[model samples]
Target: MLTSAWLDGLSLGDPIAADPLEGGYASRTFRVRTALGGSVVVKTQDNLPENLYALEADGLDALRAPGGFAVPEVLRVTPSYIVLSDLGTSEPSPTYREDAGRALALQHQQTADKFGYHVDNYLGTLPQRNPWTGDGHTFFAEHRLLRYLEEPNCHNQLPADDRRRLERIAGNLVNLVPVQPPSLLHGDLWHGNLLPAPNGGPAMIDPAVHYGWPEADLATLLIYGRLSDTFFDAYEEVHPPSPGWRARLPLLHLRELLCITAHWPDRAETVQEIHTILEQFD
Candidate 1:
């Protein structure tokens, strides 16, 4: 097999088989199978930031710390390439969804003194700032929602009124948002990012991780589609959400929808979705 330049640099001692795998916006991915019966994923980027894979590696380590949930094991990393244990992708059963909920709730127990992450990370190609803050509303307003408003794509996509309303929403967040201490979060958890585990449970990939409200994770689940009721039932049984969480789902969802609008130009529906949410708050 003709090895790609990245595979040559990896220097894995074992001979391997490689197959192309699609689905990353910023990198080329491949699934490699070894003669020794091991499978790993390798991603290569021509202009990736030096810490991209390293940050992902750190997030995987944190998610794996709680056990039960599966996060790919890091094998090799560099600015150009990252090799990780290949998590299987299969349609999950109802039991799998329930376990995913249970495991995520257990992971959420791993908390921090404040909201935010110790290190700054990227959500796709966009920078996600995570300075520690004593309050969740301030963190969400400053980092999650308003930060994207300044982006060039954001200005181009959202009209002046939509931008102003988002600002108004941010300014009044203290009253609209409920207070909650920080919990570990898979900052991006839309359905496409979810992978079924080899053990028949859930394993997540491409985490934009932080210590934030656990409900933010739940909100992400709802935006694209919902998991089985068993998932929420199991999660609540382990770590119940605040009393009025369902009402706040749109507010939490506004962050990701705005991010999608800011990052991708042709996604008019996503831009309209952000407009709908911001107008709802008005």
Candidate 2:
């Protein structure tokens, strides 16, 4: 029976079980079951920003809006810990995956006045800058991509030729990518962050949320790809992307790769992935 004040606030009595939700190296996640009734999820981070869980709770609320998916409910948010309603461990059914894709497209329909968020937040451990901007291309190019260049690792690690190519890509963004309204985005919408809910359809977790071109979400969806074609088919039918989005994925993915390298320069797999994408620019 953990007796932290926040847990006491829940008044759910002692948890029957509280298992670590292990996977990523960044945060400690737990699945807590109460003897009286239902379960909840808890996550914590060390040396965290005071608003970290608060920001996450905000993003969860934002994503839970009428999208074709579910987000675990926010039970409570403390400086170090966030308690969420348990969503269970079920993998999405094929139909649920399709629904998830449709829901995501619908979610993207929700737009913003500019290309950023009201506040800065985190992507894993790396800081994300989200100052609002009117230009989508500049927003993606500068805040999403180029900003990582200033990081301690990213600055010197990215090669000069590739850096120039990034400059070229940024300069030619208007020509290369679609100009569109800033759609609400789950800024990091890869497979790892998505899950199936017990009650019904799919739900997403661990968002790096912002308001930006929806293609940014598409670009991220396939990064460590495992989603079926049905997912994309459903997504495109609901919200067809810019004509050459496939060609643009490698370009869009540069942001994440750079972010990963910026945060953990020693991750060889990520470093290799960065090189692979940069070769296209070279």
Candidate 3:
């Protein structure tokens, strides 16, 4: 249970109730009601070795900077907790694809000189293997995918044909260099992670913030399922993907699939989805 002292420090009045919010595999999220007749979302994680909630607060602030998108306003942050302005239980806009694509393009315009975040954060619940020393492409290929695939659980889960196909795709992906300028990325922009704001615009959460190929985010969006035709249409209107992005889509998705497989080996359905994606390249 959260103590009143913590609420006092957050400037929130006496609490009414603290109820759990569904979703998210990592932090424990709660919708807190205060005596001031207001509400906010508070996320807590007891097991994270690193200050992940603080990192998320920083990333959200960065994305909400002057020209950034309409991200959720972070109210407060502590080593053990993060409080954010709640958008309530409003359903995320089905137009998420359109709004999100445009919003992300706006975010990419806010760039820095380097190709990575100032501090590293987790991807979902797993420690993201970011390139602290090498270039983005080399780091993703050598350190991220190779190491993940070499794990016994990940390797054994792939059927023989699917495994060969993934190997080939990985080999081909390593050779193809990305020439595009690196842009700020949400890093994890799937449909589940994007929610609609009260103003009808899209709001993003659960970012695996980074600086890398902007197309990588778009590719991940396409991998799970199209965000909606409206989304693709809007995105293309702002910042169209370079030629051959469709072909590269599968390659990019392979990285995410491997990450999920490594983290949740027991999810048979997820494994099958990974196999289904590889089959598309045949």
Top candidate by lDDT: 1
Model 1 lDDT per residue over 1-282, tens place? 325443454455454677888776767888887655766788777777888988888888878764557888888777878888788666665588788888888888889999999899988878889999988888999999999988888889898998999999998988887777799998888876777877667888888999998888889997668577888888999999889888889889998887787777777888888888887876
Model 1, which residues run further than 4 Å from truth? 1-16, 89-94
Q: Poorest 10 consecutive residues of model 2 by lDDT?
A: 1-10
For model 3 the TM-score comes to 0.84
Candidate models: Cα lDDT each: 0.82, 0.81, 0.72
Candidate 3, residues 126-244: lDDT per residue as tens digits? 66655553356655565445666776668778777877776665565545545556688888877767777776667777788877777778778888784677777787787777777
Please count the clashing residue pairs in each candidate, in the order shown. 0, 1, 2
Which 10 consecutive positions of candidate 3 have the poorest summed lDDT? 130-139
Question: Which scores greater on lDDT, model 2 or model 3?
Answer: 2
Where does candidate 3 stray beyond 4 Å? 1-6, 90-97, 132-136, 150-152, 159-168, 174-178, 276-282
Q: Which candidate leads the pack in TM-score?
A: 2
| Candidate 2 global TM-score | 0.93
